[model samples]
Target: MGLAVIDKSLFRFDGVRQRMGLLALLSLLQALCIVGQAHGLARGLVEIWKLHAVSTLVGPAIEFLAFYALRHFCDVAKQRISSKYGKYVAGQIRPQLQEKIFRLGPQALASRGTGSTVTMLIDGLDQVKSYIEILLPKMTDMMIISLVILVGVWWQDWVSGLILLLMYPLIIFFMVILGLAARDRSNKQYAQFNILNTKFVDSILGLPTLKMLGVDKEYEGEIYSVSERFRKRTIDVLKVAMTSTFALDWFTTLGIAIMAVFLGLRLVNGTMPLFPAMFALIMAPDYFLPVRQFGDNYHATLDGKNALHDIMSFIDSPETPQDTETKWEGWKADSELKLEGIDFAYPVGSKPAGDDTQSVASHSVAMNAVEQQRENEDDKKSDDSSESKDDSKTDSKSRRHRGRGKKDAKPIEADADGKAVAAQALTQPDALHHVSMDFKGYGKIAVIGKSGAGKSTLVNLLAGFNTPHAGSIELDGNRLENFNVAAWQRHISYIPQTPYIFSGSIADNIRFYVSDASNDDVNAAAHEAGLDEWLGELTDGLDTLIGEGNRGISGGQAQRIALARVLLDKSREVLLFDEPTAHLDIETEYDLKKTLLPIMENHLVILATHRLHWLANVDQVLVLDEGQVVESGTPKELIGAGGPLDHLIGEMGGNQIDQYLN
Candidate 1:
């Protein structure tokens, strides 16, 4: 059971093998000292029984004390070795795990939830450190010290050694059974812990919303329910842990008691000498000492073992291949970016590759899906003759409704009101299916779509935050895999609906992209972003702190700060905006747009938005519906062509907004 929990990856850490060897040597020395100390005490007792002189007693007593001290000295050495090495291994893994998380990005973490990720970064690593510190020395002791002590006992009296050996298997058998139970319970407890963390963090983030909706108490009750489940799981684990400790202690104590009876019987029969009998009796407890201590700590280290597996699995998960060799001089005025046959799908679930059960389940599901698809195709073939006339009409309508230049595009569907409504929900298999687009030179391009029409998903793909499962991306005529290319991403800036305002001064936030920007540069960038008026109202101006636990700012103000970051970093010539004005009021949106329009000049901009008014400002417009581009042309060409763009504008009340502005 002790060896089963020891992960092979544990040994992969630097100095782990060397430290294990050192601990083994120390355990052996400690074992020898135990035997020597026991022999000395037995010798002193045997001498006292013989009525030896006081001077004769002095030598045996000194020998016993010296070996006893040396045994403890070995223990101290082992502790120090394991302690320092455990901390070192943890230190090495921390940065690697953090870097992996950053590289994976938020799209990958969305399934895991915020609280769970935070717990893994903080509490999970601590558990791994504890597991290492405890497991290493204890495992070495059980392997070396226990065997050495057993051999010592056998040399003294084979009868007592035989009794201890017979009891060893029984102790291990019971330990294994209980250890498995403890492990199962511990897994549940850990899963529940992750759930609790996720829920807690979500609740905290949505606290204000809950209060406004007057449903804070309802969510509070839900949180209490999750907390109670976590508490019950914890108690169940502790129960199994206590039972394991008790069972180990019981069997070991019984073994020692039985060994004492045998030793006494042999002594009475006059078969064994007094010195050897006493030595075996003294060594009996030490024989079971390692096994007992290991069982005691087995439950404690289970959490760490589970934590290590999770951390290792997360770091080892597959990531999109980053392009390293492609060297293009950044985005230029005449540069072009093109994508063809780009496809992407969210993974079914966040199951790690190492999980055998999940792997088998996923394989079975995939096979079933394939079989079902084949069955459906067979059924369709059989019904083709009966539905021939209806299919002909459907195909004719499909050809008429298909967008120009689309490859095998599905016809856009319309409702009774004659509005194009092909919005695809996120639960579908494909987020963006067979999506292809082309951009040349520096210009503003607006991608308009309804909710769940893959607007943000498309933007994320372009920004390299999401990777397509199948796609060919070409940049300046250089064929590429995905936009995860560092050279490409380095030249792009992403601004979501709500820009993150990390705790710092306004100046520091402005210098986020270019950290070493001078005070004058930061002020100039802020002015360009239209933050000069806001700064003038503040007492400390650019030095005023904001973000978490500080003065709060409006959504428009945060957007301006994000623009300031872009203005400060002139090197990033491409900008990807995902509904950047979706959360702001109309007035704030208008003001921010006035500030943002000039910044879009002389740079390639891809803006994904539901606000159709942006079409008036953009040179080209692409209307997406159900993960496919249903319309693409200059605004002057597509606006009133009675196509998907006209349908979308009618549905979103774009004409009314235009009237209000006019």
Candidate 2:
């Protein structure tokens, strides 16, 4: 809308300052050429009007042609400079964004949907590149070229200059109004675009299930509705954009027309000479050219401005500090990972002070939804309950509990059999509260909790995707601030519920972690993962292509590929599974469990699951409630002990399963 809205952060890019300066210089020189062309053309026309010989017009004609060509040459050079720099800046920003997202880990992915992240990486960067390309030269032209041309017109004739001067503010005033309108609409359009992308990607990923459930038609209709909304938003933005373009053109055209009328009247009245008057008339359009060009592209650049802000905000965002300097050997049989009084909370806000960074809100959409839902439910319960005094006391207690630091924090009161009472609701400030635990050697431990009980939060902290606000973690007696050390993570293999299978052959996917793994080793690992029969069934064996756009594999097969990767990489001595079989059928889970248990041997396996049967294979069970450890012991000690684990087992029908099996 105005120069004030232009991103000053653009100057921070390498060579941007130098390139912009060069563009300004070029624009200045080009403005001089424009004046020369106008003067020479006017002289040539006057000579022709006086019935001069063709030979007399040669000099002025030559002068006009030379300046005209030179002016356009400068224009081309400026464009090339701006465009090349735009691409260079885009190239520079892409990898920085990728690296930041990579360092942030799966927590970043969960916070930012897979669809939105991909769109930002691809389409958003492209928009920024286009914005840079169009903005720089246009800016220089408006600042330098327009001013110089205006001075030249005033030198030719003051009246025309005054008319141009009056029109400039009017044009700008209208432009600002229209630009503001367009900007608001464009923002809404961009938001709708992101929503559409997320929903589309989510639908595509779940298309198989939709088809199987015979609800594919209904889901298709939902996508159609989303697409229609996006289309309408886009059209609204386009309408504003068109209106802006028309206003710029109308005002600039009117100014040139008014100047022509005045110049013609003066010439007819014999009060003005033909040369100066004609020159002013010739230069009138050139004076308004830059402003019109900039105004025209202003709407086009709004999306880019939004995207650049998003990217810059994300890049500037605070990340959990990594202890890269810490020296630690790989995990060993006797190595122990201990946590003392750990506490964590999701970041309160995504944006830093004074910055309108969309990345935070985009990333935290799902998390905020979950938190809001919890708060709403809590409020609903409070309203429905007749025990108003008890509710008030509970609220007061929660407030007091939140005020205390983890050091001063005491464990929530426990019931009989050492099972912890329900702690504060997860909607409280902290996701994890005064949590403490220890993992030693190759012991297998399962962390069990209901949804929102901080199971994923704990795993993320252990994997170094998150940092504890209050805690001391020690590995092998080496005091550590967080588990984000590269040396430690190098030995850890994490498998989520839906392990991503990259678009490649089965062998290539298996060799992901250990790239140099041989075919024989890949085969052995695949066999170990119980994929040998499947691989044998395929004529291409391990070389058969899978993943997106290739042959589709079952969920079980994808899990097998993930296991094969871990097995092929002998260096990974720690396996972190966050419900790897949660999506699988019962029969498939049993088969995968058989393959998984053997691989879990001689490794520190931390499994977070809702499946109670896993307790039989684990060395210890930790029951978490409201972000704190409620009860923990060997499966045998807690199964019939009327503890949290036992209660959870009964609620989930695990006791019935156990009885039926026995």
Query: Against the true structure, whose TM-score is highest?
Result: 2
Error of 2 at 472 (Å): 4.1
At residue 658, candidate 1 shows an lDDT of 44
Question: Candidate 2: deviation at residue 245, Å?
Answer: 2.3
lDDT of 1: 0.76
Per-model C-alpha lDDT, please?
A: 0.76, 0.76
Q: What is the TM-score of each predicted model, taking all chains together?
A: 0.74, 0.77
lDDT digits (tens) for residues 1-662 of candidate 2: 55745776777789988998999999999999999999899999999999999999999999999999999999999989988998999999988997897677665554455666677888989999999889989989998977998898998789999999999999989988988888778777777676667666656755654565555677677669878988988898888878878888898899999999999999999999999888988998888899889888887788888788878877776665566777777778888888878876554323322222244332332232333344565664322111001001112113334544544543322233111101212222566777888888888999997655667677776787766656567788777766777888888998877776767899999997999888899999999999988988999999999865224899899999999999999988999988888778999999999999999999999998888778878998889876678998777777777788878887777885453223
- Displacement of residue 304 (Cα, Å) in model 1 is 2.1
lDDT of 2: 0.76
